[model samples]
Target: MTTFDRREEGFENKFAHDEEMKFKAEARRNKLLGLWVAEKLGSSGEAASDYAKTVVATDVDGGEAGVIRKVIADLAAKDVAITEAQIRVRMDELMPQAIAQVNAGT
Candidate 1:
């Protein structure tokens, strides 16, 4: 292959890898967020883990927004009294930790 063609292929591979990492990071963040919310709702151990999994699954349907919506509704239903902004802030805070964890293969 020409040098230009090889360079293009390298760029494509990097893009694919970056996209995969981003997906992993987001999913991790969602799981962390779900666990935090679940704890607020008085869940623990297996119940919290299951709630986190549900949040990760919700991402398939609506990404972050959907997860946020689901958690907001859940919190409200349980009288937890949290705001969207607070959840969003928590999500932002978890993202870097999620990215680090994903990079570490944990």
Candidate 2:
């Protein structure tokens, strides 16, 4: 293979890996957010964890909007009284931590 071909392949591989990491990070952030909300909703231990996993399992059509929209509606239904701004803020706050956690996994 030519050097140019090798470089192209390497770039593709790096892009794929970066995308995977982004997905993992987003999922982790969703899980963390879910746990926070679950605790506020009075769930704990296994129940809280399960709830968080469900949050993480939500399908993302484009970006975090799917997760955030679901969470906002769920919270409203439970009368938890949170705002979209708050959720977005929390998500922004947790992204780096989630990324680090996901990247550091065994």
Candidate 3:
């Protein structure tokens, strides 16, 4: 392949990977926020967990990232010590299951 073609292929690959990474990262952030809110609300056991799931789904559907971050930051400001990265990881872990449960409930 010509050098230009090879460079173009590499750029395309990088772009695709970056997009995928962004999607995964956003999912994780949402899930992490859900978990934090569930804990903050003191939800526990099966019944309480169902309630928490509902809350998380609601927040996610609203599509208000600023609100979510504000809440997270507020909690941290009060000493929760949560960073954005931590939120992302937690959210990624829980968002998929949360989405599934929500879809089933609907």
lDDT of 1 by residue, 8-104 (tens): 9999999999999999999999999989999999999999999999999999899788998999999999999999999999999999999999999
Reference-based lDDT, each prediction: 0.97, 0.87, 0.59
My TM-score estimates for the predictions, one after another, are 0.99, 0.91, 0.47
The candidate with the higher lDDT, 1 or 2, is 1
Q: Once model 1 is optimally superposed onto the true structure by TM-score, how far is the C-alpha of residue 92 displaced, in angstroms?
A: 0.3
Instruction: Give me candidate 3's TM-score against the actual structure.
Output: 0.47
Question: Model 1 scores what on Cα lDDT?
Answer: 0.97
- The residue ranges of model 1 lying beyond 4 angstroms of the native Cα positions read none
Instruction: Candidate 1: give its CA RMSD in angstroms.
Output: 0.5
RMSD vs true structure, all candidates? 0.5, 1.5, 8.1
lDDT of 3 at 86: 65
Query: Which of 1 and 2 is ahead in TM-score?
Result: 1
Please write out the lDDT profile of model 2 over residues 36-84, one tens digit for every residue. Answer: 9888788999999998887887745535777788888889889999999
TM-score of model number 2: 0.91
Q: Per-residue CA lDDT of candidate 3, range 1-106, in tens?
A: 9999999999999999877665554444454555565566555566445544554465557554653565575566556666677666666666676555544542
Please give the distance, in angstroms, between residue 32's alpha carbon in candidate 1 and its true position after superposition. 0.4
